[model samples]
Target: MATFAELPDSVLLEVFSYLPVRDRIRISRVCHRWKRLVDDRWLWRHVDLTVYTMRPKVMWHLLRRYMATRLYSLRMGGYLFSGSKAPQLSSALMRALGQKCPNLQRLCLHVADLTTVPIASLPRTLKTLELHSCEISMLWLRKEQDCSVLPLLECIVLDRVPAFQDEHLQGLTRFRALRSLVLGGTYRVTETGLDAGLQELSYLQRLEVLGCTLSADSTLLAVSRHLRDVRKLRLTVRGLSAPGLAVLEGMPALESLCLLGPLVTPEMPSPEEILASCLAMPKLRVLELQGLGWEGQEPEKLLSRGLPHCMVIVRACPKESMDWWM
Candidate 1:
């Protein structure tokens, strides 16, 4: 009879990947053959270290040990409080990541301190990057390189990164190949910077703009002027909205539009009006209205008698019927 260790390397590697990282490490001590099988590159393709808080030193140690060239996605950081307020991703670990993870495409850091991590040390193969509630030094965000840092980058999500300002957005314009961009909870970004940054992304397809002071008309105009190819959009509005909105008229490729609102002001365009414009689009399929409570009953009534072509989605952001804005 064959034992567990007698299983082929292919099957063992696939099955062992289902175990937790710590459990794999524990099982590695069972025998040298099992250790060799557990250390396969396929088992380390996607690694998430955010299930619980870890010390900065320990995190780096693990990364240095298992940083595989076949890695595809890496997500690190949760909360800090394990004898340290800020969990650090060291420059050495970053160097190792660049050297080891040549195939890595996604890197997500949440609530981590990136003061020492070098932007140049990032892997060139990265296509998706997400930084949530991260802390970075001024010099880091302000640093400008002569050449493209992540030339192949395609998607970037910056959430609650306070230091990300117009300069960063302007810097982003250099990465013209990006297909998706999300900028949320960024207070320093303005309409000028947003327009300047967006002017070059002719290939951008998906966008989400939240936590900014941009006007709806100006933003729509900018999108029409430059990012006309965008198929899906989410723009959070603030202040007064006028009776007229700059809907994507010529954009036949657009499929979804989620307009998060500025309440129902007297001068504002009605939700029904926006829906009417959306319904006229050539290929638009989804129109989602968020945050704005129903200021009138006609829009709801119009929604009930919806047409066959497009979908009118009315969903609340903060639970149901409760006023909560992103």
Candidate 2:
């Protein structure tokens, strides 16, 4: 009779990979061989520590054991309530990660106060960074020692991070390698900063600015002129009037667009106007309208007018529509 423990190390590891982190931890205690196999670096390649209630002691232990090396993608934080301990632990954790995981590429932090993390200490190998409700500045992305801090960084998502302002966007433009950028619930970025910052992102392809001010018209205009390579755009401005939408026509390569927020506001263009503008986009293949309900208008009837080739998705709930990307 072949028991599970009698299986080879490779087969056991393969089985361990499919287990949840908690289950893996429990199984590790069953035997020494299982413990070693469970602790293998390959098992922790894409680690998500957000599932655990992170205290300073627990965080330190996890970093020392599972995240010391060979960590490629890491999603951590949710220790925002740790008060005084957060800064110290976050600083120490970031420093340890920089030393241990030099090849780390993707990082996502949620509700983690990063005020104590030094700008120079950030890992330079990062390609994607997603910050949710984090307190940090764009200064962290600045070049150091004559080299870009995150030279390979391509994608950045700042969701509900009030500290991220227009000046931060200016600093972000330093990363010429950027490909995708998402700014959600960041209200401080105005036209001036957006124009100045966007001009530098010549290679930008996908851009999303949700829950932002109407002043983003200038920003979208800047994107049309500067980022001709952009293929996808998502926006949630208050009033995307016909004139404002004309800017999108300049994007020669645009393929998909999402219009969110109250696009039916009194100041906004009518559904007919919006449909006309979208039809003018020669390359547009998909149009998604979310949370925009107009009186005496059926969303289905509007789509039936034209757009035989483009895919149209209409959703009543804004959040549900955003699930496609966010």
Q: Each prediction's Cα lDDT score?
A: 0.73, 0.75
**True-vs-predicted CA distance for residue 58, candidate 2, Å:** 3.1
- 178-213 per-residue lDDT for model 2 (tens digits): 899998878788877677777777778999987766
Model 1, residue pairs in steric clash? none
Error of 1 at 275 (Å): 2.1
Off by over 4 Å in 2: 1-20, 30-37, 40-42, 68-70, 86-89, 141-147, 294-298, 301-305, 318-326
True-vs-predicted CA distance for residue 285, candidate 1, Å: 2.4
Give me the displacement of residue 269 in model 2, in angstroms. 3.4
Query: lDDT, candidate 1, residue 215?
Result: 63
Q: Give the worst 10-residue stretch by lDDT in candidate 2.
A: 138-147
- Global local distance difference test of model 1: 0.73
Candidate 1, residue 318: the lDDT equals 48
Off by over 4 Å in 1: 1-20, 23-43, 64-67, 78-87, 139-144, 240-244, 261-269, 294-307, 318-326
The CA-based lDDT of model 2 is what?
A: 0.75
